[model samples]
Target chain A: MIRIFKIALRNLLRYKRRTMLTSLLITLGIVLVILFSGLAGSFKAMMIGQITDSSLSQMQIHKKGYVSSIDTMPLNLTLDTNKYQKIEELLSSNTEILAWTPRIKLNAMLSNFTDTTNIRLNAINPEKEILVCPDVGSRMTFDKGREPGTLLNPGEVIIPEKLAKGMNLNIGDPIVLVANNKDGSVNGLNFKVAGVIESILGPQGKEGYMHIKDAQELLRMDEPEVIEIAIRLHNFDRLDKVYAAVSSKLTGFINKKGVPEFEIHTWDELSPFANIAIMIDFMTITMKIIMIAIVLISILNVMMMSVYERIREIGTMSAIGTSPSKIMSLFLAEGLLLGLISAIVGNIIGLGGIFILNIYKISFAFGRQENLLLSPTVNITELLWVSGIVLLIAIFASLQPAYKASRMEPVDALGHV
Target chain B: MALVQIENVSKIYQTGDVEVAALSDINLSIEKSAFVSFVGPSGSGKTTMLNMIGCLDMPTKGKILVDGKQVDTFNRKERAAFRGNVIGFIFQSFNLFPVLTAYENIEYPLVLIKNEPAEKRKDMILDVLDSVGMIDQKNKFPDQLSGGQKQRIAIARALVTQPKLVMADEPTANLDKQSSINVIRLMREMKDKFGTTFIFSTHDPRIMEEAEITHTLVDGKLT
Candidate 1:
């Protein structure tokens, strides 16, 4: 076997130019796969980060029926202060929980004393909200001239940039937001416009933000009431583990109806753009299939030519008592060696391409955000996966020629010029 | 018993619709350790007869026996195994593996086919290399060697397995006169040393003169 391997290697070196060209073709294919994987991986990561950190956190815990009818933001359905405090305590106890924040979702009408528009308002605790999303304040367009914004305060509110512009509102302008209490009585709040913010995620009309106290006061609640609890974990990779641990602990703790009180959801379940991530994965898979085809065709062409050229050599070896299987092995070994060398070369070039890409600080607009950075990377396992696929294709591609050479009659092959 | 037996063997080759008789009604026996040659015109059956005994090409009719076993009954794998164990072939082209160095070419059979032990294989190869006067040229590839040196390496490769029978099909056809004479002399010396039966198919009278027994074929039959 070692003898055949040596012969295979030497034979490859015999046609140095052809061997190098074949290796170059294989290397180029692998490099394309590696580059595509890196770029797609980075894009997916960025999109996930935008959806999770900018709005959803990694996941959310909500009152059992809250998400089902969340668009209505039913003030009658909320966790009272006790259940809220209990969940907050559970979150504080788990080291995996980096931060958590609560919000009272309210469907209301916001007016600049000139025109009124429907809005979905989130009443939040300023400090904790900032901890979960440090960029929340930065995303706000505070001034009528589109200046940076500040976190909300008592008697203050923030409206969407598009809404503020259309309503002709300015910094520190006064607006009235109105809703109905559980008793079906009309309730209204007076507030000064503290900031106007751009929406990083979610649909339009989710346009208003205020202090949690304002929501509790307007809805006429005695205990601090909240409909949603957003959570951030130390590591997003462990989101499922932390979610399971939290869910199991929250189990068996029922509300008055003896039903589980809260349900948890990962950001992927909550985000509208989850399909984009799947599309990226599908695109990557399609790219890999194309790459495999290219490698298979390239290797088949080279190996077929090699087999034809060595017909007499094959006969000579057969007559000298080498088995047909050994002949097949010799060809297979050559193809495998070619793939392996190409992989090594391709990986080096791919990594170098990624490094150069990062150093250049290439940026592009993604969705509504600008200056989105590109950081391409290929992990060892992924590189190995691509290389393994290429080699497997190479082996398959060479099998036909190898079999033909092996099955040739010694008399006929020896007779071949 | 004879080491090789041919019993009424006839070989027919198809050329489109017509059949050509390469060999017909051949019956011959070769004893062990004999230097034998078959000489004929170009289209005669000398090469075909050698091919049958070498297990390279089977006859269209009749049976061939080597060491008392019917060679025609062997399957493809069995034939390959038989060639590896019981015979060696030297070709007119000096058909050395061009990519391999002389030593590696000689060691090819032992390692790949025989699965010989590393230490024993090394000793066997070097011993054969010494006898064939190619020990100094062990690292030289076929293209780097002269015609004489290449033939010597090929002969070493043929003998390295210690085969019971060695078949040469015009082994010296591609060599110069001096190289040709030297190749025949080396084969004669190796036959004496190993006491192995040797067979040659050639048109060279010089080669026929050296054979202990010469059979001539005319129009696909012994004359």
Candidate 2:
């Protein structure tokens, strides 16, 4: 048996061009699969990191029923001071809660002397806001009168970077904000531009933030009626557990309007970009399957030709008393060897390609920002999975050829040309 | 005792819609250590009989006993063991694995059937190569050697297992006169040295003249 295997190995080496062509086809398929899947996974991580770290945490708790009709502010389900304190106390006590930010969000139109833009106004506690948005401090500038780490005062707001550029507003610029108050009256107020924030949300830059109390006074709300609550957990893996617990607790708390309604959403649900990531993932998987199928066909063709070419030799071995199973094993060994060699080579090629892209800092402009697409990133878990998939494909592709070789009749094979 | 016993052995082959009888109701026996040849024209079932005797094929309607054991009753593994321990085969085309060196080709059967240590394997292979006068050509592959040298290596491969019987199908059909005589002479010398039975299926008159016992076949029947 061992002798037959050695002979098969030597025979395969004898036909160097054939073996190399077959191996090259398999290697390209494996490399393509790994490259596409790896990029898809990295893209997903980048999108999630951009969304979760920049704005939304793992989960969010909003005023009851606020999520269903976010277009219309539900003044009846307004979060009261007691409910805010109770929810904050409950979240801070649980070790799973990394941080939570209380927000009173509303839609308003902002106007400078020349330009006006509609934006979502978010009022938050600056100290807790920093925990959820560390980049906020870096985005602020002394050119806006409010320096880095400066505490914000009432009747002042931070505009998004894009909005500031569009309005041509700088430090101490007074902006007028108009919105419908809880009593259904059109109300307007003047506030100073304290800072600017750079965010990954979108090109529109339709967000602005102010002190929590100032937003209530400007909007004419009696108490702190929290509109949105963003919660960050210690680990993203415990998102489901925290969401379930927080939803159950918030269900018992009545809003200022004496209504019992609220909604809990995970980060994935809150971000539209997550769906784009999922679509990228599906495309990557489809590409991998197509690549594997092509490689399988090529490998099968190569192996079948190899077996046919050596029909006489196989018959000779059988005549010398080599069993059918042993002959099958010899062919299978050749297939496995080819697969392993190609896998190792393909990995090196894929990793090398990524490294080259990273070394050159290859990036492209998407919309407005330049983003890196191939960052030479791959987790150990993903590497193992791709390697396993390549090997299995190699083994599976060899089965039919090996079976054909094993079933050859010694007499007929000996007579074969 | 008779080294081989054939009792009404027959073989039928079906090719698509056509049925052909390659061997029909054949009965023959040869004693131990005899030099025998089955001689006939093309399509005379000579090669088919040799194939049956070599355990490469089974008789369709009769019994074959090699060394007093029923050949037809042996299962696949048993047939393999029987072929390894009791029979050797040589082909006219010199069916040596082309990629293997002459020495490796002779050493092939030893490694497969004999569990001898590495040193013993080397000694046995070299001894057979020496007997066939192929020692100087041991490092050369089949393509590098002459037709005669390749056949000598083939002969060595067959005899390396030290089987009781050696079967050759048109062994000299593809060789020149001198190389053919050399191969036939080497086989005769190998038979004398090892006391192994030699069987051949050929139309060559030289092989028939050299055989001590000759059987003639025509149209799938011995006549």
Worst 10 residues of 2 chain A by lDDT: A198-207
Candidate 2 lDDT, tens digit per residue, B72-187? Answer: 88877788778888999899998998888999888877776666688999999899889999899999999999888889999999998888999999999999988888888889
Model 1 residue runs over 4 Å out of place are A64-69, A81-97, A141-150, A203-206, A240-263, B15-17
After superposing all C-alphas onto the true structure, candidate 2 shows an RMSD in angstroms of: 3.7
Q: Which tens-of-lDDT digit does each residue in A1-417 have in candidate 2?
A: 566667767867888998888778877876777767666666667657556765565677776567767666555556678767877887887888888888777778898957788878778787877776555554455453345476467888888877888789886789999877778887788899887776565311246778888788777886667777777777877788878887787677665787665678888777777678779878987877886686678667777988988899889988888777777887887777777778789888878766665677545554344664646476567666767776777668888998898788888899886
lDDT, candidate 1, B147-200, per-residue tens: 889989988998999998999999999998888999999999999998888999
**What's candidate 2's i-RMS value?**
1.5
Q: Candidates' TM-scores?
A: 0.92, 0.88
The clash numbers for all candidates, in the given order, read 0, 3
Write one digit per residue (lDDT tens) for candidate 1, span A126-185.
889887766667667565454233487789888877778889987789999888777777
Q: By how many angstroms RMSD does model 1 differ from the true structure?
A: 3.1
lDDT computed for candidate 1:
0.86
